[model samples]
Target: MRIHTLDLRFQGIPGLIASYLVESGGEFALIETGPGSTLAALRSAIRAVDVDESAIKKVFVTHIHLDHAGAAGWWAQQGATVYCHPNAARHLIDSSKLIDSARLIYAEKMDSLWGDMLPAPAERLIVLQDNEGVPLGEVEINAWDTPGHARHHHAFVLGDVCFTGDVAGMRLEHSSYLSVTASPPQFDPVAYVQSVDRLMAAKFKTLYLTHFGAVSDVAAHLANYRQRITEVYERVAAGFREGISTEENRRRYAAAEHQAAMQAGVSEELWLKGESANVTSMCADGVRLYCEKQP
Candidate 1:
């Protein structure tokens, strides 16, 4: 199987958003579709690999976040099957609720930020359950229910490589380090940690992160993700306990995250872009979820 990295540039961030294409047998599979506006990039990626756009047989979205599964309906229209965790199936089949919620968040910039996020026809949507196996010729991907970032998340294992949507967080191209950004309302620190532990137990050495490209030394990456995410969550949770406001937490965490990325040698521009591109907002959401779940 051949895995191609498709960087969906400037979808929201100048260089942060991305997706992946995996081709096996005579057909192709897309692990994530970036966003609705990323249709051109997706086609470009397939063409770069010499695969016809119509040959894309399946699209396995780890979750329904706009940046991950936004272009699925488009792919389905192109004759591809859309597969996702059960909870996310409804959103894919009827995106009205999801679009409405996103509208409230993005307000005037919805189309520019995400493009037209239409629903995939129900007939084309395939709901994947945990432990389900999807065979793409000689290679097979077993979807594991990996939640935390979102309840409707899945981590796919294909041979030695694991396609971890946000389960693995963001690891940029040039950086030798990894960072964690747990977004809110859907971010569950405890669940995220548990999910990481589950991934670690899978014993795969190479992890395919959605942010940019591949990361080997899975132990090191997961360690850093867990350690940093834990620290950031602790800081945010403490702030919440002390009656600190959500906006204040967002501001402070954003600064700390940016500095850490800089120290890791990310370019000043990419660092700033990654820090601000809904990452901190998601972190704030994660912190809020943690606080709400606290007894």
Candidate 2:
């Protein structure tokens, strides 16, 4: 089986939302459809890799997040069997609620930013429980429950590569650069740590992150990710102990992240434009999750 990386140009940034196409024999499987608005990028990337759009007979989504599974329903409408976590099955079939919730969080740019998400008919959506193995053409993807990033998250292991969604966190380009974005409401720091450990124990040779491309040294990366996330949350937890207000706390937290990124050797220009915002948002989410778990 051959795996091709389809980079979705999220916010015009490369490697931000990578979808993969796994090929075997005469069939192909698309993993993570990216955001609905970014389907064109997905299509173009697939085509560039010599994989026909219609050859994608199945889709395995790690979760139902807009950036990850937003286009699952759309592709399912095109005759691809959509495979997802059982808890996310209903949402894929009737994405109205999920779309609206994302809109509330993302606001006015929801449609323009993420594109339209067409619901997959219930019959076309395949819901798999943890440890379920589903056939994708000639390959069998072992879908294991990989929650913590989200309750419904699943990581698919095919051959030597594991398509680890956000459960593996962000690994931006070279430089051992990493950041964990554990968003609020559903973000559980403890669960996230456990999930990291679970992935580490899996001993996969390489991990394909939704944020970018492949990461080898899976164990080391997971360790660094866990450490970074812990530090971010610990900083926030310490603030909570001092009774710091949310607004002040967020400012302080963002500032510290900015300095850390700079100290880590990230360029000043990149930090000002994109990297900084990503780290700040990640830190904010990590902070929120840590506080929620405290006491």
Candidate 3:
């Protein structure tokens, strides 16, 4: 089996987003669909690899986040079996609730950032279980529940490469700016740490992140994810407990993170682009939400 990394080149940002196309056993599978806005790029990328869209017999998603699965419904409509966590599988069947939840976070940028989310037919859904290997003739694709960024998150292990959705965080090329993709609602530091540890302990040494490309320094990356995410959460939690407004926390965390990234040698242009492209404020907001839930 061969895996080709497809750079969606979201919003003209070179390394901000990616999806993997795995060809094995005379079948094609997409690990992530990216947002609907990138579907044209994705189609083009697949074609460049000499693989037709109709050859994609299966689709695997790490989560239901619009960035990861916004075009999943479209893939399902292409006669491919769609596999996702049960919690997320239902939303693709009827994206009304999913769109509502996203509206709460994205607001007016809905159509611009992610585009329209269509509903997939229920028959195309295949809910996966933790540690379950997908039944793909000659290829072994195992999935495990990895909830940290989101309760419905999971990482797929295909041979030596593990598709670490958001659990792996964001690390752009040419810069050591490793930022966690801690979006709203469910961002548990504990779960995030555990998931990172699980990925490190797994047999797969190469991590294929949805945010970017392949990362082979497994130990260093997982360690950074554990330490830095905790630091961010702790900083934001203090503001949340001290009655800081959400807007204030966003500003504070974004500034602090910006300084840290520059100190770590990230260029100003990339830093600013990373902030907007990665939505750095949302990570702080996620930490604020976690702090709010605490008594």
Please give the clash total of every predicted structure, in order: 6, 1, 0
> What is the lDDT for 254 in model 1?
77
Runs of candidate 1 with Cα error greater than 4 angstroms are: 12-15
Residues 79-192, candidate 1, lDDT per residue (tens digit)? Answer: 788888999988888899888988887799888878877778888888888989889978988898998888999988898889999888887664755667576567777888
In terms of lDDT, the poorest run of 10 residues in model 2 is 273-282
Which lDDT tens digits does candidate 2 get at residues 1-295?
7888888878777757789988876778888998889998889998898777987888999998888898898888888899999889988899889888878877997888789988998878888888889776677898988777788989998867799988888765644757667665577777888888988888889999888788888888999888877777778888888988777777887788667767777676656544522546545755665586667
Best by lDDT: 3
Runs in model 2 lying further than 4 Å from the true structure? 272-279, 282-286, 293-295
Clashing pairs in 1: 182-282, 183-282, 183-283, 184-282, 184-285, 184-286
RMSD to native, candidate 1 = 1.8
lDDT of 3 by residue, 192-217 (tens): 88888888787577889887899888
Using TM-score, give the best candidate's number: 3
Angstrom error of the Cα, residue 122, model 2: value is 0.7
Better of 2 and 3 by TM-score: 3
